[model samples]
Target: MNWNRYIKDYQSYLRIERGLSKNTIENYGFDIERLCLFLEVNQIDVSPLKITDETLQQFIYEIAKEVNPRSQARIISGLKSFFNYLIFEDYRNDNPLELIESPKTGRKLPDTLSVEEIDSLIAVIDLSSNEGERNRAMIETLYGCGLRVSELITLKISDLFFEEGFIKITGKGNKERFVPIGKFAQRYIEIYQKEIRSNLVIKKGFEDTLFLNRRGSQLTRAMIFTIIKSLAEKVGLHKNISPHTLRHSFATHLLENGADLRSIQLMLGHESITTTEIYVHLDRSFLKEVMYSFHPRK
Candidate 1:
């Protein structure tokens, strides 16, 4: 099959079977497109079904020069998945990337903000502006719930369950989880909903969306990043903060405060405990304290 047909089929598989997000499907498609581009540039003619391991390795070698190890690893993983899909369909007898190894890149811990820094960042919001309340509420919700930017943007008004102390989150693969929202976050959201959001003319089909832009449309992920970047600059914070920074800080702060990993994982919507264990590396002293306080020998 042609590259386009293969990619389209793969995308359908990801969406229908894997339930991956659009961004994830696009990323996987981009990896294949990169391979196609390389093949064209090198005057090589090969279909996805006919591509050999040697040719794939050559493309990877060329890609290594242009991207970091982390990106290279992602590309390799994406390509491997595509080839495995082909194998699953019986289009190919064996996978091209089966023997190839991903580059060794050590686990990079996420950057986290201190509680004071978080407070300082939120304090810089211009509360007098119409969006001020919304911004504060958004930041608080982000930190309080440990939500991804995508989840935050798509959050619906119906998802808030303040009376029950929980907010429902639709995480990766469209998996839903109920995270407990703090009193502070709930209060700010109520304020924004009653005062700021109530004043706006919400567009059709977005009436249920909790957070919105001034145009009454749902907020974009880029807008969320821009908001955080502006707040970080206003506070003179040297850290390169993003929406994810608040999330990491949420997890880190909880772990440091003696919250269990499993609970944090549930709140953070991490499917694996190992994903939550990274927070342990953030504070060795906290781990030591836990050991000393809880160990029977001490």
Candidate 2:
């Protein structure tokens, strides 16, 4: 019905106008599709244009029992964006969710690994295997550049500017930024390329893709997560970690070493420095140190 048409058109707007990633567009679509399913299953018979906030609140209340507050907040946010888009297209005069507020999930700090822990995780890789070198290189790059898993997978050989010591990253919304690469990461990547990766039969479309599966295709995000998970298990590292943990570690380590928020924001490809501040939490000791070192009164 109108649900399908509106979902399609709104997704197109997100893709073409907003330049959002495929995953983000799919999530938005899922949120709308879920609302439609709720209406259908309950015999509510409402369309996107005619749906009320009261009905949405009811749907949210039902789902809240099944999901956490963070997820509930995200669903509310997605629905709000969809309605806002409909209003922008002149389908409605006002947003249905204008008055609805998302539940506080609190500012959950990202998990980070310390330098020794990161080294231990990477060092446990069985280097004799072909994937071992590749894994080592990938982990080095992940922490070195503070790359999101998406950015890590899609990194290209051409993006390497080793002489300039910078690797170009295509972040969210396909926005490009250059992040510095240290010699430690560069060395491992070069070793992987020269010793391990080059031996594989390159697939047609993925010739320039940096990280690859054993089949020589571009690596998936799931595969990257699996690699990190397997390593964490092997090393007896108890913390629930992922590729993002390495990224958070990168930013946190930089801040601990006296890097400023604006610099970390640029390096992490964040649009706002506030996001960087939230992303890399500082301990009380570090806060005291910052004040002692830089404050005018100190």
Candidate 3:
């Protein structure tokens, strides 16, 4: 059988048995696919069972030229899982990736913005333009609810449970979760919906999508990144900011202000508390401040 068939079966196992999220499963598939492509390009006819440690290491070395250690480590992990699955099913007698070590990586904290910086970025939005309101709403929703760019783009009008102060987010793997929508995000969406979105000649399938381009179609992820980058440039707030940065900032700010980590995890739609624990490292001073301020008779 071709490698792609095994890959398809592996993806299904990830989805059904492992219960991994869509984005994660895709990442897993992506890692394997990269190896498959590399092998094809080199005319190497080695099957998964036939792959040697030397071959895997050579592939890793090639990948290291483009990506950082963290990305390399992640890909290694994904490939290991794939091989382990094959071993489990008796398709392979041994795992080729078992001897490969994941590249060492330090825990890199995410960049976060202060409340003032976030406000400055928002303040520069030109309210006069047609897209201004939509842009504002987009930023607001990003920071307001801490949504991933994918979630923000896929946000639907009917998903708004505003009466319950929540919005249904279709997260990784199409997992649905109800996240609390802050009043600011809610109000901005309301404004955008009434003022701009209401008048657009929306496409049939995308009629329920919250954010749309001027052509009345769903916005692309690149478009969202461009919007954020331009706004960051306009304000001259110097930090490597993306839509995800806004989200990191949102979660960081909440954690700094003493929001419980579990709640933040739920809001961010993280499957693992470990993923959410990164926020704890963002604000060390917050921990000190919390202890000093709240400790009895301090």
The worst-scoring run of ten residues by lDDT in candidate 2 lies at 101-110
Question: What would the per-residue lDDT of candidate 3 be over residues 88-127, giving only the tens digit for each residue?
Answer: 8899876766645566764334467889999999899998
Model 2 / residue 133 / CA error / Å: 0.2
Q: Rank the candidates by TM-score, best first.
A: 2, 1, 3
> Which rank order by lDDT, best down to worst?
2, 1, 3
Write candidate 2's Cα lDDT for 130-204 as tens digits: 999999999999999999888999999999999999999998758999999999999999999999888999899
Model 1 — TM-score against the truth? Answer: 0.67
Q: Is 1 or 3 the stronger prediction by lDDT? A: 1
Predicted structure with the largest TM-score when compared to the true one = 2
lDDT by residue (165-233, candidate 1, tens digit) is 999999875899999999999999999999999989999999999999999999998899999999999
- TM-score for predicted model 2 compared with the true structure: 0.67
CA RMSD of all predictions:
12.1, 12.1, 12.5
CA lDDT of each candidate?
0.86, 0.87, 0.84
Model 2 residue 176 CA deviation (Å) reads: 1.1
lDDT of model 3 at residue 246?
87
Considering only N, C-alpha and C atoms within 3 Å, which residue pairs clash in candidate 2?
A: none
Which stretches of candidate 1 lie above 4 Å from their native place? 1-106, 279-282
lDDT of 1 at 226: 96
